[model samples]
Target: MEAEYDVAVVGAGPAGATAALVLARSGFRVALIESTRYERSRPGETLPPPARMLLARLGVWDAFSTLGSLPSHGNRSIWGGPEIAESSFIFHPYGEGWHVDRQRFDAMLASTAADAGAEVLYGMSVVDCSAPDADRWHIGLRGESGEAGTMAARAIVDATGRTARIARRLGATRQLADHLVGAAVHYAGPLREDGFTLVEAASSGWWYSAPVPPDRLVVMFMSDADIHRSLRLTEGDRWEHLLAEAPHTMERVEGCRPIAQPAFFAAVSHRLRRNGARGCWLACGDAAIGVDPLSSSGIVRAIRTGEGAGQAIGNWLLGRTDVAGAYERILDAEFEEYMAERSGYYALETRWPHSTFWNRRRTIDAAMRQQP
Candidate 1:
């Protein structure tokens, strides 16, 4: 007999875990699948204040706060004119935030889902999925031991971050535009005792330095990879060069040594088409609509979507599919609001020196006009 669950969540990251926790706590049987066997630390450590509120709602606030996560005040990305120019300063308010240990933070959230009574299967790979009918989905997953199995669920939630695994399986084309790419490394540092600092380097791109723990800090840079072309450098060399160009950034890292190799990924500005279409599935987090990390809204948005999806899916499992419809409506509205805000921020980047990097992002507003 095929395994059956009231709800099947693919990807046990923040969104999926939160969704699973919500459903399980409410007495619904849930199955959550995670692709990786081990959790690893990553950048995007700072969470906006709004996200902290969501985390509190999920009951993980105390655990997170006690983990030595640094408190975040706000974010400073290049807004208007040149970096040195007074007109260039535009501080976006993030309110109360935290720079967390992502690996631990994510694992803790997923474990909460288990503690709440959801069956979480880590190291399981989702191979395929299908909507057999309007009311159910059939999912195939490969276990860590290489055994393949199938699961049936009333609904599926995709929280696969940027991979959009299920979206691609459905042949959904992703809209990718060159905006910025991110490279980061964690190190010991002359940590900013106050909060995070994001500096716009004249040529190398933007750099972010912040405290994560008393002894360790995370530093990252974002720029158009097509222009920087530093993507080709070996990890160690790349990090050294990044440090060399941003002297102000270096001052913060004065006595620190790298804790890990530098890492980079294309930070393209893109969103999936038909976030919810044929299947009883809803995409959350970077899986649905991705905004610039410059906005520092990624983690907050993920938690919010998780909360929204949980409420929506709970209603659907109880035979109120109309609640799912309402969820999609709210998601669409939120996406529009976020895009508008992000576009305004991107536009501000153009008012500065017109380099290929800023110019490329400048067209985002015009491009979003054709997003239909």
Candidate 2:
């Protein structure tokens, strides 16, 4: 017989892990499925300071804090102007932010979920999900050793990052504003700028460089997918040529040797038409709304949405109603606020009015304005 769960949360990142942890704590049998085993590299390692309270609320704060994550004091950027600028996190109630080891951070979340009583299935791929009726979701799974299994759940939460794999399988279409990609390269050297992150803009795109931990920094170029392909960033000379366009960024990366081949990440700024409320399922994290890296809200947002979904789903499973309504209202408000701020920020980069990258940003804003 197939295993059954009150909720089967897919993609055990921040959102899924939190969802599982919460559900398990609420006395529900939850199954958390994750494809990656967190053995390799992934991006989006930075988290704002406010996330501490969220982790604390979820009861995983002490474990996460003990991971020796690098503390980030603030950010120094040349964004919106030629001269460099600084924004300190000290103003926030929470002291310093963190640039975490993303792989380990994710592992910690998964481990915590398992300890909390959720069946944390790592290195497992969810092949598909079917809703035979209002009663349950039948999920197909494949194990790491090429073994196959099936599980049933009363509810599903798609926290699969921007992929929205499970939600899309159920007919949800992603709404996109622009095509964005991040090409990153890890660098190892002396900690040149200890506590502050760096952002510098160029004619084609922007650059983000931040110290991760111990003795390493990760620098990445942000641009549209087509633009990145056009520039042939895979080639060292071409990558360095565009990188040098930002003199300030060049200075930060100085003396740092590239420790890995350039890595690419999908940074597309987007959201879904309506987050999953169909057949007792909800989408969280980037699966629900994918914002740009410029906001630096990805991890925090993921954890927040996970908590909200967990609570809302818990309420519904226990005989409460309109969980989806509350979930939708909260996420919609966040999306609107983020879009407004994004528009204002992009408008500040008028220096690159003729640049293809800037043009795309403007076009996206103009389209949003035309929306009814």
Find the candidate with the highest lDDT and give its number.
2
| Candidate 2 per-residue lDDT over residues 77-160, each given as its tens digit | 897889989999988898889998888898999889899899988889999899988879999999999899999999998999
Local distance difference test, per candidate? 0.73, 0.87
TM per prediction: 0.87, 0.97
Q: Candidate 2, which segments miss by more than 4 Å at Cα?
A: 275-277
lDDT of 1 at 254: 78
| C-alpha RMSD values across all candidates | 3.5, 1.4
Score candidate 2 by TM-score against the native: 0.97
- Global local distance difference test of model 2: 0.87
* Candidate 2: residue pairs that collide: none
Expressed as tens digits, the lDDT of each residue in 204-224 for candidate 1 is 366777677656767777888
